[model samples]
Target: MHVSSHHQPLLVALSVAVAVFTAYVALDLAGRQRATAGAARWAWLGAAAVAMGGGIWSMHFIAMLALVTPVPVAYDLTITLVSLALPIVVTGGALALTARDGLAWGRLALGGLVMGGGIVLMHYVGMAAITMDGVVTYDPGLVALSALIAVAAATAALRLAGAIRTRAQRAIGAVTMGAAVIGMHFVGMAAATFTFHEGKAQRWFEASPVEAPVLALQVAGVTGIVLALALTSSALARRSAERKAREVEATLAEERQSSETLLRQSEERLRLAVQATGLGTWDWDMARDAILWSERTYALFGLAPGSAVDYTRFLQAVHPDDRAVVEAAVRTALAPEGDGRLEAEFRALQPDGAVRWLSTQGQTHFESGASATGERRPVRLLGTILDITARRLAEERLRASLQEKEMLLREVHHRVKNNMQAITAILQLEAAQVADEKAREGFAAVGQRIQAMARLHEQLYSAQDLRRIDLGSYFAELGQGLAALHVGQPVCIEAAVEPLVCDLDTAMPLGLIANELVTNSLKHAFPDGRSGTVRIRLFREGDDVVFEVSDDGVGSETGERAKGLGKRLIEALAQQVQAQLDINRAGGYRSLFRMPGTRFTAPDAAVAPTETVG
Candidate 1:
């Protein structure tokens, strides 16, 4: 009988297909070594080894099944099972060693020894399981060649396993690895030379050997299935890890949302506070030159609420006369040397032509981005605007009313002064016609006193502040009038007065006291035609003002001077002003009135005359 060695084209092709697919699956599974760690790593590693080992074993067995001879051939059950187990165990351990993250040449070589040794053992051992077959012999050279190919391919595949990145690279690597594995198998097959023993083939049917074609189909199908499962498991594991990561991210997002919610609530509360105070806020982004105004701020600027506005528009809306003031204030606030404060009171011109008095206060805030020139700068301008039109209008109206009252009061003072002057003129005319010297002197004294009162009214009517009087100026005029009345008298009136100011009430009593003292000095101080000086000195002593009038004439410790109507009037006037009165006759006739200084303003140097009547 004649037989051809098993080289069935279909079986060879089937083995090659299994080799290629298993190589791809192993390469794909290699990613798991990186994707997983701990116990999970070992699990994926086991799956990958199965695909690689099974493919090598299945390819060899299918090639064996392709050989046909006149003698029957069957495999020993124990040896065949052993051959399959050898590759799975050896490749698993080898792959685990190679999966140590980096490609050290020693580790790769060691891995190749384990993987190639197991594959060679599986081929030779499965060949040994053949029962009723002739002695299978191997060509030493070809056998060595097969082992070399297996080892080289295993080492190359290990390098590619870690390096595989994209689908195309993995596919290319798979094709190359598959070719080496298939080539190694075919080389091993070629080394085998079967020498049949005639008549021994009849014993094959007694053992009931399985059909070789059916066994080849089973090996190819099983190898394909195992490779598919390994790849599928790796993909599922990756998906599970990603899902857990997504869950963690979702949890973090929720916490972030809560924080943002609290911030928004705080902002809302601040906004409500501003609204309650009737303040309109503005935020300006200086970098963008953009202005964001609160609803109330828009209304304050006389613009339609919620409308878009910029600095240019804001300036246009300001009253023309006040525009420069507004610009200058902003410029000062933005200056590098200035404090970041802005204050401006300007009139805002509305679209409808109504004008509003607006007071704006702002603070500039600096930030890194506010750096227009890549350094620190003021980037934000935040402020408030208040409508002060009502307050301003009220102030104007009150001022006008005060002016009206002042004019009416001045008119009243003028009328009183005119009436007093008319009475003085009548008294003077009547006194001039009288023959009695004592009576004429009495009329002249009364008329002079009345004139003094009229002069006070004249001062009040001319004063800018009607409620206060300048005692220095008033006394100067009073002294001149009294001196004029006593023409050719031996007394020279000399006043050394400070620029003292006092209220109407205090000044009136002080004026009358001065009049009484001066009149007495002129009437009684210089007896026997003695020439002397009447000195009026007004100065401040501590918290009281002193009004002193002295004369270098007749001395008086008098209770005698106190008996007269002028003295009585002086005492009453001093008492009315809450002034302490002292009479000293040791040096000369001196009367001092000390009035509380609280009723007087500080002496004004500006209002003091360069020259005064003596």
Candidate 2:
């Protein structure tokens, strides 16, 4: 066996790698002890042992190949086996840490002793297998030191496993193992130097062997540092994994408790809901003639406590007139075409001769086995019963009130329309005799305003609800009526009305306003055979209802329409409706008003629109 000095570095590097890997295996095992339990930790320890054993074998082969001495194949094989056993012993100790009943102090001590003895025996046996072709030397001190190093490695591993505490303690344990590895490496190197070469033997520890001690020192130092670093890395990894496991377990526990609490709350809510509704639960067996009911159910039937009420008793409670119907419902429920549960509404006759209606519904549950009679035991039916008498009475009252209100409203609208027509005729007849044109005009305006108000009620009566009217249609109708009222040079009135509906509060004021605007447009807008157009538009803007009326006619007469009753009325009406009115003479004449919501009432000095000849 021969090798260049370059090969020596390679061999030393390989040995250091193996030493680091071995420390990592020990560190990982120690860290996992606190994190994993049961079979997992044991399985991990075994797997780590197998990995470290492979590393050990690799280190041994590399070292054998780099040896300057020609070592026999048998010797190399024996050395490989001895190196492999060290990791296997460390793994067994790690597995023992996870045992349900941990290894006692005596057992740990005994195991360590056995492992140390085996290492010593293997070392001596492998040493015997070695044959140095030209050197034969044996040093008792070197053998003793090597045995001490092996014992020290075994002791460090056992001590670590026995009392591994915090991550820091595990790190210390790894350092201890690395130190033991370093010690064994140098001790073996010193022992190798004692081998005779060309009838001469050298003692490396004599402090005079520079190459051997320095190389050995370098290898031991490097291997120890690498092993320590590897141990720290593995320990940190295991500590992090353990912390994560604990956090996850805590989260899962909290989630489980939260879910349980939610489920309980839901169940309590359901129970309270059932109680508040005055509903009683019942269960019935169709075959065995068995019936079960909650206390509420018994109270519903006007029965005292401890009273037994089977299907027969249940049937007896039904009124004679409704008995056939109740029976038919049960028959339908039990039939093949229907589910084995009855949902029926029927009258129950109490002992006091009072009749009460009950709504019963339930579902059926089939038995697992047949009865002695070779038939399945009667399926059970479970359900709830609720008293719906109050609901039925309220519905009846609502229906009757709706019909009565409809009839009364229609009659009221008809009578009001007839009276308004009578007033209009009376005013027309009276106006015919009026000699003054102003008085006649006043009476005509009065009748038209009255008609405008009448149209709102008229619209309501015809509408589905006598409470609201379509403002657009109501305004348009009033405008048309005003145009028809004017005789000379009929005004060309245009109503641009939006489709809007409001309750009476909004409709009445709008209708009257349209009447005044239209009357003014016709009376003064077109005069002396000159026809002009009057435009009235109404629409909703956001929350405000706007009405605009424009007339292309003669300007306002001083002290005439502008300062007359009509202008006063317009102002008063706008104030009553909480509306703002803007009068513009920019383009002939234009009046605009906007109101919020639908609260309108008649106002004082509510002037009618004044008439002016163009």
Candidate 3:
């Protein structure tokens, strides 16, 4: 039997509209699936597949419901439910395969085949659920055509779902995917053949197995549930992504603020340190021959702030005599063979024609690599300069004062020598006039003491260092003079003196002490014309300066010497120099004095014996 059918225009339009909306929902869910990971990704894929299957089934069921037949049409309850699972399971597999970060041709082709086969089964299996007294079958050629259409539609739908991203593109993809699904449904419906016997009309509307309207309502409810789930999940995902974005921006802002605060503090510290040190900084760009000076640098050169300067201008500001040397130092710093270091001191000429000494230090920065036509060259120079005018002027004044002091010291020594010589002359004249032998001896002794002082000043006047006097040399010379005092006495005075240099203040006291001791030894120890050797020794023993005078002639009695002027003089001189005097007369007369806390120029001064006869 031939069965004639036509679709209700409004229902057909509703079916098409439902198909498009379902495609849109499925696409939104797939987009969410691609963005998810772990278990959530599979969850979204299942949701997308269920939504797409429910939507495609609803479109096909609604179109079928729109077609009016001559007999009442009903569906088997179990088969109708079983037919719905075909699209869902197959779509889930297809989406899981292709809905990811990427898609490949092989996966797409395989997914299309599975999806198309599932759709064909969904349509035909749905037809088998018909519970009429008629038979349902399909023409082989039409069925094959419907299968091809399903395959083409499935391929197009998967491609569209994968490619769709923006709202505008999604809308277009939804419409196109909806049309492909609708075409597959129509082709599958066209392949179906309904064969009815004459009694099939009697079973119409008599407690039909499944009514089309009730089934339509059930499918619509399922479609609504899938739509609700897909939309709500998408909204929540969008909200989560936006919140994360805001958090990241806030963290970045905080980090930026902290970095800027540190940078500002560092710059401020550098500026303050430069100001406190009176240092001026500069940077030079060699390629442009341009110079950049800090505010302190401008003040150093007596130039206005923000004034442009170059190497030529810098040389013009330098003093004429020191300009050439400064230029040479800069060239050396920039030389390829050098370490790019510079230190130079020169005079800077201020605009007011006054000169200020400037000390500059700098470093050059060179290119890391050579250019095509040349070797590496200096690209930039950084440096600092400081004013040293006050220091230079103070040094000059100090030098001049030192020279003046030296001249005054020389004059003092010379005048002292002349004054002592006149005193010695007076003492000599008095000694010669004295008739009493003992008093004449005293006068001669006083004259000799004065002569020794005169010789000291003379030696000091011509000495290399005015502040120090060579004690051994002075004592040796003084012994020669002492030996001259007793002519024809047949006594030998041997002076063993060490060349120990001592401060000038100790010279007079030490010389006078030695003179008295030696004079005492000669005057009394070798009495009755008997001759013996008198030894005068001066050397450093341990931490003390030692002076000893000893005689082999009958050792002088200290009891008798205590009443003489020489003994008292020796005691006074020893006290003046803080010396401890030890007198020993056991073997020979040995008078020794050790001055503590005496410093010598050399720790070990060579000693040599100097002899004179009296």
lDDT for each residue of candidate 2 in 217-327, tens digit (9 for 90 to 100): 554455455445545655676668868889999999999999999999998898789899899888776666778887788877788866988878988998888889989
Better of 1 and 3 by TM-score: 1
Clashing pairs in 1: 6-66, 6-67, 6-68
lDDT, candidate 2, equals 0.64
Each prediction's TM-score versus the true structure: 0.58, 0.45, 0.53
lDDT of 1 by residue, 44-139 (tens): 888888878877788878877877666667778799889989988988988888888767999999998888888888888988987764577789
CA lDDT of every candidate? 0.83, 0.64, 0.81
Candidate 1: what lDDT? Answer: 0.83
Q: Which scores higher on lDDT, 1 or 2?
A: 1
Supply the TM-score for candidate 2.
0.45
Candidates in descending TM-score order: 1, 3, 2
User: For residues 256-373, could you state the per-residue lDDT of candidate 3 as single tens digits?
Assistant: 9999999999999989998999999999998888999988888878899998798889999998999889989998999976899999999888898888898989999988665565
